[model samples]
Target: MTTEPCVAAPVRRGVAWHTPLSVAVLCAAVWLAHSHWPLLRGGAGRLAAADQGWLLLGATATLATWASAALAQQGAVPRRLPGARLVAAQFAASAANHVLPAGVGASAVNLRFLMRCGLPAARSASALAVKAAAAALVRVALIAVLAPACPGVVRLPGVSPTGAAVVAATAAGLVLLLCGPLRPRCRRALAAVGGDLRAVHARPGRAAALWGGSLAFAALHALVLVAVARSVELPLPPARVALLYVAASTAAALLPTPGGLGSLDAALVLALAAAGAPGATAASTVLGYRLLTVWLPLVPGLLVLGVLVRRRAL
Candidate 1:
């Protein structure tokens, strides 16, 4: 008699845990959105019917952001993923990001999705890290390139010594933890990530997709903000607005808030105000941005997440 592999049992158990937990999380998210529906409606009331056309354009840009993310994710790994399913996964992941802090929800969904696609957890996680690192680098490059074009548009407050020390300590601790106790697995994962990164760079198609998608992702997000700014009649030029968005997003990245909820909103409003947008316009722009990117697609995104969970696609 042949004994079944030990991995099979745990894989099966994981499905059991994953499905219920995902469904529960989806339910909780929908319930939370429902409780906040009145606030969303109030925010929506701010937009004028005259600006509906630009708002629709913003919505289209938001949709494209998910597709760009999927493309970038696919490029991070050598393997080809089914396009439709991968895009769906990104959509679900975006929705998940709003509910969990610092993208934990989205990362969990994507990790599970990659596993279902036959990637081991280590490779999947490596792919994720690669994608994140690439995207972040591209974002910083964009800011560096654009900041000069719009001088005085982006103002960064000086970092306090305490904050600098805290960041340095955190990085040092992480380095120690990885090199000391977690060296073996960390080494393996880093090796796989390095190999994949090298392979992605060698192939023109994958390289273009990775870098292009990342650039497009940041640009599309900025476009959404620009569109919102226009809709609210914010006084800043498009270039200034984009730079302000990039600056605010970079600052907000330091905070682990879910979907950059409070932190991002505050940073954006402050940035816009600093860039010469009236206070009311800045606030409205933030509200409209959140409405399109977060509140509007939330319920449908949660539904897709639940369906994917039940189907074991995540």
Candidate 2:
């Protein structure tokens, strides 16, 4: 009885704290939108001048990403998931992704969904890691293949030997500093991920879905950017644009940003400029891309998330 009260008290307090925080965040968003309405209006006007067909194509690709994500999630585990619910969870996860840094929100939603589907917590986490690893590998592979076709599109900045050595030394020092405290936990996590990877790959069907879906997800994202560029009549070839998208995304992934918001926008703008887009054109292209991928689907995605929560599906 005493323990029950203690637990309930903390739960109540947590809810109390969260309610006010949520309201504060909502108010801040509204305030920012109102203050920045002119910028938003200008971006919208630019998008209005873009080719509608290409914009539609970008929107379609954005919608397809959620399905690809669900497929990859299923491929990470041997067990069959309820298909519709899985896709819905992915849609909800997208909205959640925009709220937390480094994909934490989406991962949490998927982890809970997997647990609801009966997997143990450790297994669920391992499956998520497998999916993430496959996505990273696919992104790198796409960049490698596409980058060569567009010569000089992505140039590595020349770094002096001294600078390189300093960076390497700093990385090594950081690793050594944390290694003692984190090594055991990291080892256990890696072992679990390795076990899951082996098991998932042993089944050819699962392996195909894992890699194929990851590829499709990355490709679709690139396609969204390409479509946006084309809509604005940007002079770059579609292939080159796709390559730039993949490369910029890969680099931006290093930053722990919410859905790669600021990091991705800046990287994409810089990449487009490097490819010869005028400043205004590059900014408009990015604005269009974000309109299709983030803002357009946000409200609906949040609704889906709420439904899933009410049904206890996540």
Candidate 3:
């Protein structure tokens, strides 16, 4: 008989037992933390399923923004990068990011994936930085354009107008500062991102395409937020939703909780409540929106996490 490898089979059993058990424990923790919700009554029960159009819109907007971001990167990447490949990588990365603790885990995985695609580690870092900066800039631009439209976003519960202004300023300042002061290579990296209009000087059309993609992303994403808000008949107008979506999103990202989890849910619920929704109704409405927005994406993301780990891609 051929000699067998000495790995213990019990190790596999141990792992299997631990993984699910840990997941169950974490899930139980989440449930307990969010258990403060009052039991939904009649109107609240209806709110849970009412006017789901905004959820759909939000989903579509989210999908569109991610696709556009990937496509834009492909257009400006150094090598003749394949758009489909990057998009797939992005999807895998997103899934990983959503389920994994802390957001950087996904970025690390994405950076590793890119490195495997033949980029040097240092260069990959630069590319990630550039991509992040561009996205932030675009987000800030959108808020400025849209924020004026929804000046009353200040009215949302727990929302301080001054806090909103500071957030917007910080986003703009940080991104612009990074883009301007990087080394020559970093500057080239941004150009390779198509943010360098000079390289495409002979073809301004590419630059136009980049701006167009960004604009489309902003519009569609704002529409989705407005729709999600409407699903519950929150007192906030669609214009307010459109304009303040970026700011609210930035604040959501700042939360320490993984995936912003219960914190985001609470923020949305409170915002709706401030918009004149009953507290219980707001809770159910927010919960329903999460079922559509968070859970829908999260399930596939967990599966993708397996692929990332198995491939050692992170």
lDDT winner = 1
CA lDDT scores, all candidates in order: 0.85, 0.84, 0.57
lDDT of 2 by residue, 1-314 (tens): 01111011112334334444445445544554566567667777888989999999998999999999999998898877888999999998987787789899799989988887877789899999999999999988987898789999878889999999999999998798769888888889999999999888888888998998999999999999999999999989999989989989889889999899999999999999988999888988998898788776666676677677655576
What is candidate 1's local distance difference test score? Answer: 0.85
- Model 2: residue 305 alpha-carbon error in angstroms: 1.4
Candidate 1 local lDDT, 183-298, one digit each (tens): 99888888988988998888888888898888899999999999998887888899888888887887887899998889999999988887777898899999999888889888
Least accurate 10 contiguous residues by lDDT in model 3: 1-10
* Candidate 3 lDDT, 1-314, residue by residue in tens: 11122121122334444455346535643453355234324334564576866666767776776677565554333444445545666665655565555567457766766666666676566656655655567777877776666565554448589989998999999778777775565666655544333443335554454555556655765666566667767666677655555665556777766656666667766666665667875665556545444555554555554544444343
Number of clashing pairs per prediction, in order? 0, 0, 1
Model 1 lowest lDDT segment of ten: 1-10
Q: How many clashing pairs does model 2 include?
A: 0
Clashing pairs in 3: 54-227
Off by over 4 Å in 3: 1-48, 52-55, 154-220, 275-277, 308-314
